[model samples]
Target: MTLVYFPSHFKRAPAIFFFAFFLFTLGVTHFFGGSVSLLQAGESKAGLPYIVKKGDSLGEIALRYNVSVTAIKKWNKLTGDKIFEGQRLRIEPFPLHSYTVKSGDTLSEIALASNIPVSRLRELNKITGDRIYTGQKLQLVNDRKRTEKPSVHVVEKGESLWDIAKQYDISIAAIKKRNHLKTEVITPGMTLSLKEVPEEKHAKEKTDEEDPELFEYKVRPGDNLSTIAERFDVAVSLLKQLNGLKENRIYPGQTLQLRPTSLDEAVHVVRSGETLSSIAFKYRMNVSDIKRINEIEGSKIVVGQELRLKGAKPNVYIVERGDALWEVAQAYGMRVEELKRLNGLTSDRIYPGQELQLGIAPARPFGTYTVKKGDYLGRIARLHQMSVADLKSMNNMKTALIYPGDQLKVTPFLQQGSEWLKISEINWDDLMGSSGGLKKITLGNGPYYGSRPMARRQNNRRYYESARLSLWNTYKRAQKLQAALDRKIAKMGRLSDCLNGWHIVIDPGHGGLDPGAVVANLDGNGDKVYVVEDEYVYDVALRVYVMLRLHGADVTLTLLSPDHLIRHSDPPVQTFVNEKNEVYNSRAFNRGNSRSHWPKGGRNGNLSRRVAIAENAFKNVPRNRRMLLSFHADIDHSSPNVPLVLYYRNRRTGRPDRASKQFAKAIQPFLGAGTVIRGQNVFVLRNSPADISVMLELRNLAYTDHAWALRFEELRQRDAEKVVRGVVEYVKGKG
Candidate 1:
């Protein structure tokens, strides 16, 4: 080694020069997207490990891994962007446990792809809207499911696959494949395992079959032709042609069919000067067929426009009010099974204005058949998949007697059950007492409770007094609550439409794999009943969602429950189950309520997913117009657990936001006596960009308290109304 002697001043100058040179190199490399960082020795290796080298920076690494730079900082305990050469860094939880937003990304897509519940994502990220942007950082969490016995279901009598699926919220396709079921037929006493996933997937659904995963795209607030087409992976031109769109206008709630073309059809591009007639002639098809398939009007054809050729439009029939599958099939002279197959219907449910596809061929002669030689009534009924009795009824035949030359009605009308008047049996002995049970109330020409003939004076009313008292008390409570709400609303003026056009998101707390809290007991009939936190909260959330929507606010739900399309509960949901079946709206609940299928993390990821969902959902709306209502129930072992309203506050200031406080106060009065109003920096609420975020703990599930609030449908409905009234009141105050 050669050594040069130098003075102390000169040596210090050389060191300073070298330090300056190093800073310059780093600045140039980072700005130009060049990797220059080198890993330093003794740096901790935690999370997904990475080594720094030439042309490496936080931004560059994040982009490569499709993660947010902030996430890298958090995982690596990084305080700044400065990284040294040879420094070992933690880059994990990046691609492995976190997701970065991409252009045109929706909360649903991220939830589905990452196997994290969208609600969990929203909760973690504190998202209030469905709108997400490119290059945003999102946290992923582990789906936490309680350990329990292996999930197995026994077939019950009178239960179909559809019924079982709806009850469990799992797709039929998933269940069938799991149990190796060859058809949708199962017998009682058969036990099936619902836990294990099939290694080999079944054949995918055809273009026309209704896909259980997703059948149609329900247009959202800001959807257009281009966005819808891209999301469904179809061409814009093809979408327009298939949906019969003459322009690029669509409204929210419009159902757009993604796949309508059959495998037999081919795409044909319209050349300049070519008319629909010319195209039909070239393809050996009729002009009418061309027009129908292409959704074309008149003879105008644009250059480079794509049109489906040789595609015949399947016959479509509009379902009128009160129309049933049997009626439609009978009118068209087709079998019910054939009609179901043609329209991809699984159940007998039909709503007014629903479009159903009829078979391609012309309808055969209806309600009449010419008897021929060797033809029997039984044979004709068998051919039509109808019962002999049904055929006889349609033909108005008294018996199976038939003549060879007689014309018989072939189409059978739907069987109607004879309406038997309901006879309510009254037990006079139990209702009346032998003594003077009704002496005071009975009408007579003598003193009220005093006298008459020995037999006629007897006023027996066994249950009359007690029953009357009980009914009177119940009615009084209901009347009191209604009056209180009325008085409250009257003070606020005409505010029925206060929520008009506002964006509201209702989130049910603790769902899917996480049941939150479980209270098991027996019902009046000695059958097991559950007051599950998630189940009860979901029902209440659904009720609020419906009420808000009816008030003209654009309302949506953070998670989806079984039979979710039901806006009104007919008999109301009186029972709660401890099934892990609720899913964040965009992903399958079986995707493990995201089992977040993620590697173990610090906390359950479901809430974060929910917060993220809310954030993205409210992203497009103004902060003032955005609101999130998270519904929950408390398990109180002591003390009266009246409804509790928690409003979001800033931790530093120790005070709630003005809007959130107002919202809480407006709702406080209606939430029953002793309604507690709290202001705190709640994780779910504080993260929301919305001006108002309130968490409503609707009921106290304790034996001694108001536990019936969870088990009684009537009580639950009342609670829902109370919360809705509060919201309306808040909007009124703002107005």
Candidate 2:
């Protein structure tokens, strides 16, 4: 049976009832978590299909599978020992359970009930969203073994290892070892080895708890900390310390760990979005110390991966062919001595397959030497504390020849008043005050930075003072009020001068043949309705053009009308000639005559035209000007009510053209949230010489009322105003 779900109107009780029932059923499923096979049973030499009835239980499933009732319940993790009707259970004859979707289930909700994250659920179901309708087959966790064993309890919100251990009569340490927990702190979705445990062994294990063993606990409804603590016989403080929990409150699906002796040796779980540097910073320890303790070599950590803090070095790397000792050390983000000591290497030369130690190398002493023109290895070595042979050896150099660009590594003899200094993020004011400040400056390294020198040349970088005065009060007020907004903050003394006074052009999308969206009339005249996306766009463009021009910006259009401009020109098309262009052009050219549309007219319609316009606009502007923006309208053909906006990042030419992803980030939230996202490659912004170019999708005028259309027009005008405002801010160096 195919199950189709119509979106429930959230106003009624039936929807709420179904949703609650589904959650309840899922929660109850934890009891019978494994599978049973009927194929092995004599009951089914062939396949058989069974429909579920209201009063059926595990016994019926087992009978159907030719397996025992115990086997069926154990297989499916059914907590209530019962089943319902209109329910279809698969009799695979093999020990496997395939869950079928019920109404009102989201992927996140299902994943929570199944003791996993949405990612794992997606992997299991091969699904991307909570879009499953009733009757959809979903692969459940596969477990074939059947015993008198109790259902496995996963650590859920608000539960602790102690409670779980007591419930299952198992030792916390045994559970920890089974689940490979390093700390007493566990998380929701961690499966615990719950079985019929011996009381004496459990008691003995409890008495010895030190670095307590971690285990899983399923949270029961209405269970609180004080209640759970008394039941588990573990200190609430100990539990809190184990979980890094600040509050006593716990959720229904949270998992907590418990140990026998002392609280478990403190450890941290590397979570997603956490880097080793960040972890080290958070723990107030050096990254090297954490790395040394956890034995982690690279920055690869998946969410929920545990790290032991009991100080252990990671495995040493073996030197192979084409490996340089220093290079290898650098690869490990360490020094040669660190690598040598870790692997116990006593010599400079390392052959293929030679074992090398790996750990955080101890910090080295200060070293420095000035370069003497025309001085070779022997002279340079003598000036420093290193011998000629040692210098060559330390630097891994086979030759004595040194060039002007070569840096000599030397041991330093620190004298009084000698200090190392850097400009440390040059300030805009100071740089602007100096002559030729933007002329690619080299401080420590050659050609460190390249920037435009206009700030220095004009000596007008002081304009920031006035701009600052004008905006600071406004900014503080906005911040104080906590206005709904997006803000970008830059540290240090200077802003990007290259982005100032940028001349950008906007290209509104889908004009001419592309009569974009067709809105059916609610009236019963059989009257068809249509909106030429380009026409709506042109309205937007004219408003934008006037606004941008008023703000002293240079603007251009790719196409002025529905008639032939670049599309009808020779070379067959004026822009990006790809499949996307062809589709867009065909759509536009076909207009309302859907049948006469040219499928291959051009790929990525008007892309080339837009790019050409931007290119021309950029060339026409002064060398100091910046980027471009292409305007467009959202279209779904499926659901036009949900609009979309997208941008392009760096193009193939290595230019910093605006990324569509950024545009989507900037505008998507404004479109009423949760809009569908898509990517496109067009020519205009793609080919522009500007630092960045963006394509903006304004709105979906189809299916919109007259009021909505007016609002959309207003939004377009506001967006245009924002574009000019952003440009002015950029030019003033406030952005």
Q: Name the top TM-score candidate.
A: 1
Local accuracy by lDDT, each model = 0.50, 0.40
**Residue 704 local lDDT, model 1:** 15
lDDT of 1 at 441: 24
- What TM value does model 1 have? 0.32
Model 2, 1-735: lDDT tens digits are 000011111222333222222322222111111211111121221222345667766664554343456555554565666677865554443322455577765554444333345676687778876677887766655344323334355454556888677655579987776554678887753555544333233333432221111233434468777665544434455455445568998765445554211113224434323566645643456887775554445654432233443342245443322233443554344665666555544432333223355554443343545464545554455334233444665576766667755776664431211131111122212322222222334321111122211121111101111111112232233232111111111222222232335576666565433434322211111121223344445546645554444344545555442111111111100111111111221112324323233221135443454455456667756764555666665432222223344444343543332343434434332232123334445555556666556665555432222112322222344344434433444454323
What is the per-residue lDDT of model 1 for residues 251-283, given as tens digits with 9 covering 90 to 100?
Answer: 764555544311112444443234675456444
The positional error of residue 721 in candidate 1, measured at the CA in angstroms, is 0.6
Clashing pairs counted in every model: 57, 56
